[model samples]
Target: MIKENPLVVSVGECGLDYNRNFSTKKQQRYAFREQVKLACELQMPLFLHEREAHKDLLEILDDVTAENLTLPPIVVHCFTGTEEEALTYISRGYFIGFTGTICKRDRGAHLRDLLPKIPLERIMIETDAPFMNFKKGRKSSEPIDVVDVARKIGQVLAIPFEEVAGTTFKTTSSFFRLD
Candidate 1:
């Protein structure tokens, strides 16, 4: 198991994906629960993948907290959920990872609006390579595209580009610490 591997830094690619439903809801729920427990038990961070399942996701996390389990630091990767959902996750002390979705003026408008609601400290930026095409309709996003994400964030929040880049870099580094 990855938990036994010293090189493992976080438990992930885990969470509910209702949009595709590639995995049955039962299977996803069970796996998500187990992974959350494993991460909590191991004191490791979580890199989650969620799409159109915010309600269920929050319920599950709340259940774990009800059980007195201390959740590890969690970053909802490529977060493009609703403003309410984003606020809910923020309230739970979970971090939000922004992808190129915010670059889409129309589609990303809500996220831009919610950005002001989220504390900068709880923010992280990602390229979501081979997944997000945030680079002006390129084949797919690459690590270099992270600059675009940072730039959009700076533009929306009215913060300087350098500060956005430096803060997110620091936040990500601290969240996924080894040991």
Candidate 2:
């Protein structure tokens, strides 16, 4: 179905979520593996969701790649992982998607330090909240919240907000091959 739909640019929002564990570990791994295989088979980009399951996720990726299946372009969405995790992903050439979560001081304090470590070209901002209660106090997350995320990145990296916005826009567009 996804391959037939031209509007579906990516096999998105699919990955492991050990923190929630809505599905058993066995179930999550099987489903995640299927999606990974599908993305590789279809040669489509993957917009992934991972929480507290980085190890297993990496293992699955390695397992797939070990089989001589080239992994497709992968973006980890709504990233709220540690600095080490960020570095690990970056080292492997995977894009990290930061949401409004990074705008919050208490929860995202670590991210402030990690932002600079990320290469400018690989950075991407996601304003639309993905099952997250972050940054916006009580107001529901919205697309405009991306501004706050970009501002936080600028503040942390000591770059101008406009620069952050422009850079992330360009990087995101290029990553997804957007026109």
Candidate 3:
């Protein structure tokens, strides 16, 4: 569908997720590599997902990018990895997307610790809507909750919310080639 349609903005929310065993590791790797191939073929940005499979995911991406310099941009969506892991991806020149999980008091500590190390230009914030209910009282999250994501990032990075908003907007826009 993406290959046939010009309206398809990016190539995926495709990658490996071992946390829930939704699919076997082999199946995930095959699917992920195939999608990366499609993204490379189409020259569209990638919207990626990764859980406990960073090492394998990185290896696959490395292999894909090794033979092709024209591959589209890649964003590791809803990243919740450690500082070292995040730094590894950053060093490889990929963007990292954050979600409302960073707003949660209990779960966000590690993310907060690592946020400062990520360059503002590479940060992309998301809602992970209908899933991440970051607020204590809210039943579900919506797209508007991206503001809260930025707010939490601002708080952690000790920067103004507006600056976070502006930088993330530019980062996402540029990554997606929205301009």
Candidate 4:
């Protein structure tokens, strides 16, 4: 199906969701593994979605890595993990995507502070459309809403909003090797 869709740049938007565990662990595992393999076989980058299943997710990656699977680069989209988790993935050369949800007053604010600690080159911005709405009083999000993410990240890093947008845009384009 992806081969038939030239516009699809990713093989995933897939991973475990332990937060809700909407699917059984075994089921999530199966889907996650299949998607990982598909991403590798297709030579397409993965848009990874991980929730409270970090341990399981990392374990799967380790297994795949041990098998010498040539997986394309991955981005942990709409990341809401701890700084330690973020650093762990960063150390392994995965890009971290931030969303407008990071602008919230609670944990999101902590991630905001953590952002400046991350190398600018290792970052990307996403909206995770139809979810993670951060606009004041808004209840949903859209891809175009990623601009808010860019702006918030700019505030966190003390950089101009356009600079953040341009830099992250370049970083994402380069990471995916997109034109």
Give the poorly placed runs of model 2, Cα more than 4 Å off.
Answer: 135-137
Q: For model 1, how does the per-residue alpha-carbon lDDT over 52-96 read when each residue is reduced to its tens digit?
A: 999888888889878999999999989988888898889888899
Q: Give all candidates' CA lDDT scores.
A: 0.88, 0.85, 0.88, 0.86
Instruction: Give the TM-scores of the predictions, in the order they appear.
Output: 0.93, 0.93, 0.93, 0.93
Q: Mark the regions of model 4 whose C-alpha exceeds 4 Å error after superposition.
A: none
What TM-score number comes out for model 4?
Answer: 0.93
Answer with 1 or 2, whichever has the higher lDDT: 1
Candidate 3 local Cα displacement, residue 11, angstroms: 0.7
Candidate 1 to native Cα RMSD, angstroms:
1.7
Question: Superposing every Cα of model 4 onto the true structure, what RMSD results?
Answer: 1.5
> Which residue pairs clash in candidate 3?
none
Candidate 1 weakest lDDT stretch, 10 residues:
132-141
